[model samples]
Target chain A: MKFHWFAEVTYGHTTAEEVKNNHTWVDAPATMHDPLKVGKTYQMFIRLMQLADRSNFDGLAVNEHHQTSFAMSPSPNLIAASVAGTTENAAILIIGDSLALYNPPTRIAEEMAYLDCLSEGRVIAGFVYGTPMDSTFCYGVPPVELRDRFREARELILKAWESPEPFAFNGKYNKLRYVNLWPRPVQKPRPPIWVPGSGSVETWDLVIDEDYCYGHLSFSGLRSAKPVVDGFWDYVDQRGGDTNPNRMAFTQICCVAETDEQAEKDYAEAVNYFYSRQNVNPAFAQPPGYRTVKSIAHDIEMRGASSLSNEDRMRAARGEMSFWEYDEKGYIIAGTPERVRQRIRELATDLRIGQLIPTLHMGNLSEELAAKNTQLFGTEVIPYLRDLWADQPDHWTPAVSQQRVNANMPQVAGVAGN
Target chain B: MPLTTQTVDDAQIRVWSAGSGSPLLFLHGFEQHPGDAPFLQRLAQSHSVYAPELPGYGESTGFESIHDIFDMAMRFRRLVEHLGTGPVDVIGHCLGGMIAGEFAATSPHLVRKLVLVDAWGLWIDADQPADPFVLNPEQLKQAKWHDVAAAERETSIAQSHPDGANAAMLLRQQNLGVATKFMWPIADRGLSRRLPYVSTPTLIVHGESDGLIPSAYADEFARLLPNAEVARISGAGHLPQVEREDAFITAVETFLAK
Candidate 1:
């Protein structure tokens, strides 16, 4: 299985008390953020990602959120641009640009192409209908029109990337007299596409029908994700889509150290900070018409099977979980590298996920420890997991990244003294 | 009156209509269409009240087919013409009030008189209306009524939707989703520009305690129309007709009579 270095890039300066006072993390007050601290945080993430690239990680995943201290990245492209020039390996995974948020979404095609060229053809284009808070509340997109806008944007971006000559395109949401990308992507047709969804069947159908990679992204860990992740595989099988595990990616929080006790000691406070700091207002979480009635019904049916209760989720969010309980709940895999690797192996196998995006640096983690975490996971955990999905081919990531990561794996192992 | 379906311009619309006298076309609010409410039943006693759920709302099929507020007004005109009643008196409340203003402005010959109650569509950035979309269920209840308990008395024909179990949820979303087209980012659709063209005698019935649109909008509506009067009903929020039916009826009927 491929291991990607991923983290929410949470603003580490805010405390749990401050978060509670701010009310909602997504629409938290502007005055709460110290611009200097935010700047340093961005720098820290970039430095950590660069280390991961040198340590043989396959991808550097960055995501987008708006008006939040939780994840300061409003645009993933800026972060991707930073690492693309500095890093020699790792696919610049923009997981991704919110399609509906961009006007005349050829802007996305242009930027992604620029990144691809900068990185020598290593870019994974992740198309997303952004969160209700990001798209509807922050950007003022009508929830009902969001999907339609995303669909139009996706079609436009794809067309702009592929079309050799300038073309006229008239769509419901966007109209372009000149449809041309100045720097087309280095990949022949386009970069590999990854679409992350939170149990929306429409999104599943979209990825499956187009044969793009499907990412079931959640912070709920194994227990919360089991129902949706398992349902996706079952649905893929039922629909006769390729059941190649490489096409499925899952995000997990991984805390690894020399020993199990050391891992807990290092990550406990940060783990609490990571889980507790983000409290989205219920209204912002669910805007009217964001999810279809059909999708809600599907959720009602699918979510009923999961053993994780709402109380468990609340306790987890409140940072009330003991370090061991968080591990038992699968919110984080905390232990020695051996233990983490074993747990992840079981997780990937059970979920049929070939791409594992392990969040290394969580909330309030020191830069030193984060770098250490990145190095350890990149060396110890990633090399061990390659044998798991060795038979299956991964078409989801850029080939340049794959080649670079594989070639550097032995060197990374040597650094680990293995 | 019973709920039924009507078609205009090949678009299916759910309609709630009753009573018989002078033809009175009632346009319900931005939310759900009021079913057999006391105000509607009272108005029906004196006039033939016809309330059609706006396109893209509950059981309404023309939402996709209609684009922009002008298109919506044109649909209203077509529906009125289809009714075979000439120059009916129009009463529009909240989001409906905004649409009624547009309909009266664009189709003056089709409308005899106009009534706008706690209307949206006029945007005063300085005194912007409370965001109806952002308000949660409890907040919405507080914003929409003088007494929270009155919400129980508020009626909707959509409650008996054909889609079983999740009908209330489905219809609420369907109706509000339609509202988001014109009222998403802001409630205004430039109806203020058209209100100046409406020469029809008008009444602006406002709930005194309307937190959603605020009473200032009622004054703005009155200020713009050629001949319009304002009636601020006491002990009511956004839905004056539901909260103060007698006062609402008296204000509207007096204006139409004049």
Candidate 2:
């Protein structure tokens, strides 16, 4: 099982001018080093990795974004490369390189291959179609076409990685006359592939069909994510696929300290920095046009799906809407190490998920606070979860392995086959 | 210098200013705080505009106790008196306009000229009910009981620049939580009557599609004031400064120039 600590590299500003006008945009370093260079941004990822290493975490995670102060790792592969050298043991997981956002999937495949080699086989690659508001506008791609393009991109990359030699393929988004990938991954076949989603039903089916790790990024709230995950499991059950709990993972914020009170106090500040400043941007979330039809439909379904009264919806929306304060019931967990462990166990059992990706370092959280939380979780919470569910063999594994293989797979002749 | 902040008792009150000219105090919308940015900087270039964080809004020191818009206006008047060294031109946006209107009505001697930008005052027929876009069901239900406090806020910045990036930033800066709390069924229906007592030169600029406080209401506001000029900024909403910044600015600049 691979464990990862996710960092968004978030910052809160009163206006965009503060970001655009500031000198730190160019002067600041992406990697953490000197205090004078602490860009509130690079500091976020640096803190995450440092904590991941200190806590014996399997990997440290970072992501990509454009034209926003959100987890500013525009080129996540760069951060992945930095993490490759920064930490020795922890696998550097780039929770995404938007395949659709990039013009050619080969760029992503080649980069992941290089990153796999760089990490010495410790690379967990994540693919995602861009979200509305950010990636859609940045790439100038119409939202309607994103899903088809994404699928085409994924197929191309998979062929590039798994195929023996250069091949040719044709699709709506890309056409390759010669398909050749250099420096194939260190791991046989390929490094573990994880697709991050926000409840796209089609994505769930695809993940299950391909036997790839399915990750649900519960950025909104746990209750909000129920229908989405339920949909994923339903698809798995329908296919008669052996449901490996480890096949499912959830990304949520978790902070643990010596005491519940201390954890709450420290977590509140970071939470405030996130909800109050960063995520509150209406532009960050307008309407879904970036993912597959199922994901977009799921989001649309949830628009009026929850039975919460309009007043409650408004409250929930307002509660979860800001970039300044903590959403008490949203995607975060803040408590003592013991309490955190129990909550994780309950969530895992209730959500029926196997692996858990906790975002411990978030929203301007200090290095000290992040490191302490990591260390405490490693020492206390992890053991408690393992001990509490000691009887369940299914709960024991890191990453669940599937026994079935795609037998009699067709040969990829050329662009015509795609 | 443009927008600046000063921490008062843990809360930070941001202030915006421009050229070392006559003071034109510009108060932002209901949920916003003053900050260093292009919008404030541009305003500062013409008149020495002073935009401050209202009590209980933004980073400003929140009200020590529960208070209404009138109570806030009283505090704002005090803040202006304390901050201004000489006669000043006063301006307000949305609820800020109401506060500025009330302030000018009450303390006519302190202000030389008054510019109310889509200010909220006077109980318009109540016939229209409230704007749906501004307040959702949660606010209406919660408003029934004063016990349930409104949520904390981060104001969404308005981006009017040609580049889509500013628009994108504007979307991110939106803090509906603050707006929910700052907004309430307004009281103080006497603003229309009090307008006759406002002795200062006044400019009333409004958006054509201001559903919350319609353009008709802006006209009525101007009609009541003995010394007033009324103008409509086309293709704008309640947030005319954002939707029609060029026209909004031109009206104010022309009024102030006169």
Candidate 3:
């Protein structure tokens, strides 16, 4: 199994009252956050990611969100550039660039290629149709045209990377006079493509048809993810597509310490802060045409008459759950390395997930505690889980980072080295 | 009054038509067609009314063919031509107002008189409009009506369809999705540039209490059109026809008579 380091760069210092009073996305008050603190936070993430590299993580993932204090990463490429320049062995995974937001899309083609070159071919390109709030509400791209724009941008970027000569291109959403990339990606054709979706069948078909990795990136943990993830695998299996675990990625918040008690003590408040601070105005959450009627129907069916009620979801988001309740619900995997390893193993095996993007730091987590959590998880939890899906080859992450992580990973005491 | 489906090229459109005299085309707001609401019925009393659900809204089809506002204008033009009524009086509310404005500007010969009610098409930097899509039920009620209780009594969604509340909710979502084509973002599709070209005598009917759009926009529209007048309906918000039906019909009739 491949492990990636990830976190939602949530602004620290936002109070519970602030979360209650205002939304965290689109129109969230900007004056609530301090600029100097934001800069320091960015530097802190870079420093922590560098630490993650030294501790034998296979990849470091970054993502894009706009006009939100929930995640301060408006431009994930800037952070990816920082990680790529500093980290020697980890794959710089941009989980992704919102394709429709960029004009010409050759800009994305150019930038991804530059990151790939900078990282010496260690980059994974992700194309996303950004959140409704980010794209339709904040960026003002009509929701009806968002998917069309994304498809056009993707086509343009791919052609730009592959075309040897300057070619004129005409697409419905984008028209380009010269379609050639100056610094083409080091990886032949392109870097490994990973498309993260919240269980849209169209996205599934695209990933399966193109043989790209598909990531179910959500903080909702196992119970909330199981139905959709199972639905995804069922769709893939029924279509006669590859069922290799390596092609699937899932996100889970990880809280680790020397003991289970210490884990809760260190992470309880931060985890609460992480979940509670994400206050999305209901109107901005789902704009018209953002999800097709078919997709919406499918989601309602897959969500099925289940135990996870709407009230549970609301309560969890409100930070009303106890830390142990949070862990029990699979929102967070909190405990000692031994317990965390056991839970993650079950989670990975149950969901058949090969790539785990474990969010180690969250809102208001002290830099010291985050470093320790990263260290413990890197040294203890990851080494034991390496045997999982080891039989299945992973083409999702760059081979260079995989090899480096494999070489540096401490050998399990009882298990034989590959 | 009867609801009929007409096929134009590859697309099918659902149109509500009634009465006979001068031809009048009624374009609905961002929501679904008001159906056989009292306001539409009242207008049909004096004039032949043709109210087609915009393409892609509800059962109407051919939304995929529309590329931009120009294509939308052409669709309406074809719909009017298909009606076989020579130039008609056009009344557009909210999103329909924007489309009606476009149609009048592009097909000057087809529109005899234009009425834009709480319409959207212009963007003023100093006085930006509130985003209709983002408002909650309470917030939307506040923005759309002078009296929330009266507006609730006038809501057409619950009474228009045979299906239950869930289906009504779904229909509302579908209608708004179609509205996003022209009204999403700022709702300004360069109509300010085209308004000057409209040759039809125009009436800008505004709900005085409309929280969705400010009264200043009526002046802006009047300033741009070649011949236009502004009429503010008292005790109304976004939907003047629903809130102050008698006053709205009188203003529209007076303008069409001219």
Candidate 4:
């Protein structure tokens, strides 16, 4: 399976005081963590890209979130552009711009198409309706209106990218007299798309129906996600759909060292810092619609259905339910080579996860620690996992390109299959 | 629309031709084919824009043919007739624009609208025009001769470096060398006398800051074409499309829309 490292590029220590101390620094929300300056972030991202390449990683991933301490990537497109210029042959994946946040979707289509040309067609477009809280309040998108807007934008972007020149599109979110993207991507029919979520009912349903890859960003852990994944499989089965385990991918906090004790000692503080920051901000911890009765009901049912321990629920309440908990039962996979490998293997087999995307830079972990984890994982865990999947033809492959995924576009618009 | 590629002797010619509108046959300058100009992409959204690959560009073949502007004009006339479309709107840029003016003079009936941009073949009085490709010490200082301050001037042309030499190569390789060689050249009779003879609407687009061809040439070119209207694009040098694309597009759109 393909492995990628995700980072929020959080400025571990830039506080409200720093902005207040300097008039030129500009005004910022006291509760938010802004991204590092363009030049520094660009330089840091380039270094990460080189490390990703050295690790035999298939892709370098970046994403978008705004007005919060959780993620500093407000313009993922800008980050994608930086990555595009630095890498010659790696997949530059932007989990993408929030479609609901953009107006015409043509802007997304045009920018994505331009990026594809710049990278010679090494772009994977990720379409998402961002978390209701972050997108709605920060971006001013009404939560009730976001889903339909997202669907319209996604359809409009797809048509604009794939259709012949001088085409006209009159979708709800966008209308154009004529449509054509200059310097079209090298690949025909455009690039692949990955939808990001934690097994949200709509997302899983669409993943199965469309056959697109689903990146279950289960930051909380395997126990919280087991029911969701199980629900996805059960839904597919109930719908009489073809079973494809390779469609699912999970992202979790992972760190590795020579020994479990050493790894925990090295990582615990940073992991604790990451959670502490979330606790202090609380905005990241309590997303809008997250505390609603309906949402709480779903979480409770999912937790009970998965048979998770009460400790996990209380931890979830304390905003520490993530796998990084020291109980060895959390979603986090940390420790010695053998210990971490065993945890990953358990999830890979029992959970049937096709790929494991690691967020090694959580809580602004030291660059040295992040790089060390990457090197160790690349040199150690990957080899072991490959061996386990060697004889299994049904296992998913790690490398993917957008051109390959965009080939099967929805030919008939507005028709739901499956 | 019909796309046909045929052998014009040893050279392969590619043409996108169709319909019974004003037959506008367009030719782009060096390193540029029909696609580089979105003028056609946008115009095609409306009128019948017939863009062909000028030899050695796009899909057209011929590393060496049409030695000068005169030769290119002759070959273009045959293309207009071969495509079986009528009274043409013959448009060209740089050396190609000079050839279109010559084509209008020689085969007056073939063209209905003659448009030229930063065209060559007209020599303005020793005004030290901007040669975006060459600085030659004197031109470098002269580039700063504008009314703007020296600091702002340096910032203005900072990105214009690296491309100065490439532009000079276009002059030496295509236009200058061939113009010096042929006696029956592209700029034969200045076409100034033929202005009244040619019954066609004309538009002469000149770059305001064109160093290769002075803005004065637009007036000269417009005065030479009887039915011509003149428009100047601001902040534009030799390649107006690159510097002021929106303005260049709007000018062309306004003229064509009329």
**Which prediction has the highest DockQ against the true structure?**
3
Point out where model 1 deviates above 4 Å. Answer: A411-418, B158-166
Predicted candidate 2, C-alpha RMSD: 20.9
Pick by TM-score: 1 or 4, better one:
1
Whole-model lDDT, model 3: 0.89
lDDT of 1 at B254: 84
Query: Which residue pairs show backbone clashes in model 4?
Result: A2-A398, A191-A402, A192-A402, A323-A330, A323-A331, A323-A332, B130-B211, B133-B164
TM-score of each: 0.96, 0.54, 0.96, 0.53
Cα-based lDDT at residue B77, candidate 4: 75
Specify the highest-lDDT model's number.
Answer: 3
| Segments of candidate 4 deviating more than 4 angstroms | A14-42, A279-300, A309-324, A387-418, B1-258
lDDT, candidate 4, B191-231, per-residue tens: 45555565578888887766556677788777766688998
In model 3, residue pairs whose N, Cα or C atoms come closer than 3 Å (at least 3 residues apart or on different chains), thus clashing, are none
Residues A53-170 of candidate 2 have per-residue lDDT tens digits of 6565656777777655555667899888877766656666777888878877899999989988876777778887755544554554544455666788988988999999778897
What proportion of the true contacts does each candidate reproduce? 0.43, 0.00, 0.59, 0.00
Candidate 1 lDDT, A1-418, residue by residue in tens? 8888999978888877888877554569887788998999999999999999988789999999998877889999999999988998899999999999998798899999999999999999999898888989889998888888899899999999998899999998888898878999999799999999999999989998999999988888888889998899889999999999999989999998998888889999999999898878887887678888778878877778888988998999999999999999999998888788889988998999998899999999999988989988987888877777879988899999989888877633432222
Worst 10 residues of 1 chain A by lDDT: A409-418
